[model samples]
Target: MWFKNLVLYRFSQDTDITAELLEEGLSHQPFRPCGKTELSSYGWISPVPGGDTLVHQSGSFLSLSAKKEERILPASVVKDAVNQKVEHIEAEQGRKVFKKEKDQIKDETTLDLLPRAFTRSNITRAYIDTRGGWLIVDASSFRKAEELTSTLRSSLGSLPVVPPALKQSPAATMTQWLEQHAATLPSSMTLGDECELKDLGEDGGTIRCKHHDVLADEIINHLNTGMQVSKLAIHWNEALSCIVGDDFLIRRVKFTDTLQEQSEALNAEDEASRYDADFTLMAGTLGEFLKELITVMGGEEEKEAAGWETKATVTVEEGVEEDAPF
Candidate 1:
């Protein structure tokens, strides 16, 4: 499956857990439906639905899925029920219910309606590169990524992974790039038409641009005025493209069709074989891309802190799972 957004994490220490062990550990928290009176439930699920295996592995790459089920109870319905209950209590007591009593009634109403609530489900896909000691999640936002990591930690007992934080800020580096001539950029990098700049002062004003050369005098003047580049879109090596944030998160990734053709040409006889081939190709390409990105951003010092690092990289070129939850 292709990852839309990357939330990279570096392993805190060397982990010796094997695929078999991971599968065993995850089996303990296999996905289950939401229970009565429960607002939500989260657990592990098969990376390939209908497949018996929970952990899908292609070489050193391991893929997994976390499923979350949340009950959909409309707030209006709950409020109406609570109001009715409050009225009944007030009539019984021959007086209006106190604020405390009304709050309790609201809580009770929610609990009563939860079991009958319809459920909405979402699945978050994640992969680990055992050799590279990285965890990559296909979540567009940090909150979603954190949810996936939290579920992983709960299942595995301990997952010491954190987001990458560099000593040299990307914002400052990007600001410098914008203030300079286009010829000064890395040989493999070309600025795209979109960017986000933020003021460095306490007000923290932000500006976003599209379809405009970021190196223009107007943009440079803002940088001269202490506005730092917070996000930038760039084409790398004429093969990969993405919007990279100051925090090192990469989103809206697009790879050339050459990579797609290679994936389609993979002639695996079985589902497992096809999966392996896809992961290998995608990971190899992305791994190289990330290596270059880290080098350009100024290499970060290795640490045991909670942060993420690029492991084996994969892209949408692997083909999307028809059942993927976006």
Candidate 2:
């Protein structure tokens, strides 16, 4: 386990103090003139598991499937769940505040008093600990810790100032995150819908969609022989770890989960069918295949967009009924 803590301090004045001149420095406007200083510059993994953790997920998988098939619940229920998620975030982030003070003191022996000291700004301190799991000690005695807090943001780009609503796990690490906190969620998503979005390869940009069940076949027969399905999936997962489903953040999703229904759709060429987990298709040439993938995925438009040439200008929302057409 590793722990990283950051502390930044700001001062009101930059002057040295001596015991004898304490009173004089305090009483005097300018303590002995100090030499001018140069312009100051400011400076700045895991594995599968066993036991209850695994068992609980297995049960959860079945339970969630049953719940999902329970007619999508009422709009009110879905709204309540979303509202609860927001409130939870607000409570965790809450607010950061701090206090500052100064006092006067005189050196009895030297017959001198020290001037009052001032603390201009506040310092923010954060503690991150990872053992069996991970926890963040986000309390700060200083005010205005946003910048310092953001410094902790990884190159991957996930905003971690606030506690992550999604717990960290192997299989569910990311899925858990999207379900609980994704802002612009894809609606009409089925219980088993699974989409893998990615931003990688050539120009460091690429998108591809293949039938979920035919995933093995499609990957094996992709028009481009250079790309590997499993490798693409791994990259997509890594990038999403940092994006964290924010509205301003545009995510490139890759549709990966290939289900039995999805396989059938490609055979029948159903464009709107949904794959098991509602994964979006890669854009362009890949999108056509994505459309077919959707047929079995479920929760797609009846006939897809009339002008649906590619996978742009489209969005899926929460609690929406099955859309897209074959």
Candidate 3:
């Protein structure tokens, strides 16, 4: 499966964790269908469907998928049912149902309707670079990514991971790149046709452009007016294209046809083999791209910024109890 977005997190270099241990920890929270009256449920699932392996492994790269099931219950339907029950109780007892009684009736009605509610299922994919101490989630939303990490933390009893924060602000860098055109922009990256610029001040406002020259005078004027580049689309290293946000999230990722052709030439025989090949190819390429992008952003230093703390490094600790309840 291809990832449309990435939420990157870095772990301390000293942190040690083995693939086998990760698999064991995740097995504690294996996917289970929602209960009769449950509105939502979440748990880990096999990255490769039908495979007994909870963690899909290829070299030091490990992948897993989290499944979430949510039941659909309309508020109007529940409210209507609650009102009908309230009316029936009032008629039978010949007294008006008070707020407390109405609240109890609503709870009862919700429980009765829950089992019959239709459910929708979704899966979020995440990969762990054991060698690199990186956890990359294929989620566009921060909340969804946090959910996956939260479950992992609960299962493992500890998780030392945090989002990447560069020393220099990406918004400032992007704004400078647009203002200076090819001069300030990294040689390996070129501006694409889409971008988003926001004012640095409280009421500075925002602007979005599509299929327009990012280096045009009109766009430059906004950047000149103290608006910072919060998001910009760029083609990097001539292999991948994506919209990079100020928060460092990459979205709408697309690999060039040349990369796809190279992958096709490999011609893996089975599903598992193909998955391994694809994962390796993607991880290797993106790993390099990320390194270059970091360098472009003036490289990561040892300094810790506010709100960005290095928790436990992903290292193996001996004699520790691994048998924590899920």
Off by over 4 Å in 3: 303-326
lDDT of 3 by residue, 1-326 (tens): 76778888887544577778888999999989889999999999888757778888888788889999999999999999998988898899899899998888888889999999999999999888877768998877677777788899888888887666577888877777788785865678888999998887877787888889988999989877889888888898878999888778778789888876777789988887777777778887788888888777766656354354556523211211113110
Q: TM-score for each prediction? A: 0.87, 0.17, 0.91
lDDT (CA) for every model shown?
Answer: 0.77, 0.24, 0.80
Runs of candidate 2 exceeding 4 Å displacement = 1-130, 133-205, 229-326
lDDT top scorer? 3
Worst 10 residues of 2 by lDDT: 60-69
Angstrom error of the Cα, residue 299, model 3: value is 2.1
Candidate 2, residue 157: CA error in Å? 22
lDDT of 1: 0.77
Arranged by lDDT, best first: 3, 1, 2
lDDT of 1 by residue, 116-153 (tens): 89999999988888887778888766667777787777
Of 1 and 3, the candidate ranking higher by lDDT: 3
How many residue pairs clash in all the candidates, one count each?
Answer: 11, 37, 6
